[model samples]
Target: METAQNQQQAVCGKEALDLLNCVAQSPYDQEKCVALLQSLRQCVLNKKVKKFSLAEPHKEQADSSMIWSKTETWKWSTKLSH
Candidate 1:
């Protein structure tokens, strides 16, 4: 069940990114794109994706490369001990 939810979140994120790319490629539809962007943001917030953490399991090592940080960026380091 958790895996399914994660997959759903991935789909939503990809769709939002695709919409953003389309907006970037075509500036004439800024209004519509902005509306869609806001909707996507709200959806993500409601789902708490922005609050996701490294504690969550990732399918690939590359997917765990970066972690969200308030002060600085984080990158997975094989050399560092946890």
Candidate 2:
């Protein structure tokens, strides 16, 4: 079970990295990153990725990753619509 979870994390991590790199390369162009963003979103849904954290396991390292769940994404979108 743990192995399967780790695999999923690896896939999601790759997708996240791809999207970040795309955005970094084209900061002013939202259109360019749309496909990569969608790819990451699909991976997140398919893998049931609940959250992502940094590699450092040490408690001293600050975890700055913006962890979000499905509900949180929904709430954020709804706020934008209002």
Candidate 3:
């Protein structure tokens, strides 16, 4: 069970990383990252991933202002409008 969970996390993590890299490389033109973003969204839905941590939290950082901060936990909204 743990192995399966790890594999799912890996898949979603890879997709997310790819999207992040795409956005970083093309900050001015975000259109290029659209496909990558969609891919990550699809992976999240397919894997049924509710929440995932990008990095470990630091003791000093108590602010939750940054959306992509190391302490923030990303959650995927399952409700999609059709």
Candidate 4:
């Protein structure tokens, strides 16, 4: 069976791939690119919103879940930074 560590690594890899795809699909669309990154960032921010250090340890993992939002994601990122 795959361990937690393996699962974490898989999540990380997927996030990286997703980010690459996001950029690849919108090469010339600044808004789309920004939106993609912001959405990814939001997934990270939501999980660690309780912390004040702005440190996201399992950010990639949390962001890779199927429940990830495509909309209002940037707004969540804003919540993390604030």
CA lDDT of each prediction against the hidden true structure: 0.48, 0.52, 0.54, 0.44
Show where candidate 2 strays beyond 4 Å. 1-9, 57-82
TM-score of each: 0.42, 0.50, 0.51, 0.35
Give per-candidate clash totals.
0, 0, 0, 0
Best by lDDT: 3
Error of 4 at 19 (Å): 2.6
For candidate 1, list the clashing residue pairs, or say none: none
RMSD of 1: 10.2
Identify the superior model by TM-score, candidate 1 or candidate 3: 3
Q: What's the CA error at residue 20 for candidate 3, in Å?
A: 0.7
Error of 2 at 21 (Å): 0.5
> What is the TM-score of candidate 4?
0.35
The residue-by-residue lDDT of candidate 4 on 34-72, one tens digit each, is 776776567665544432221233353343332233442
Q: Order of candidates by lDDT, top first? A: 3, 2, 1, 4
> Where is model 4 more than 4 Å wrong at Cα?
1-16, 49-82
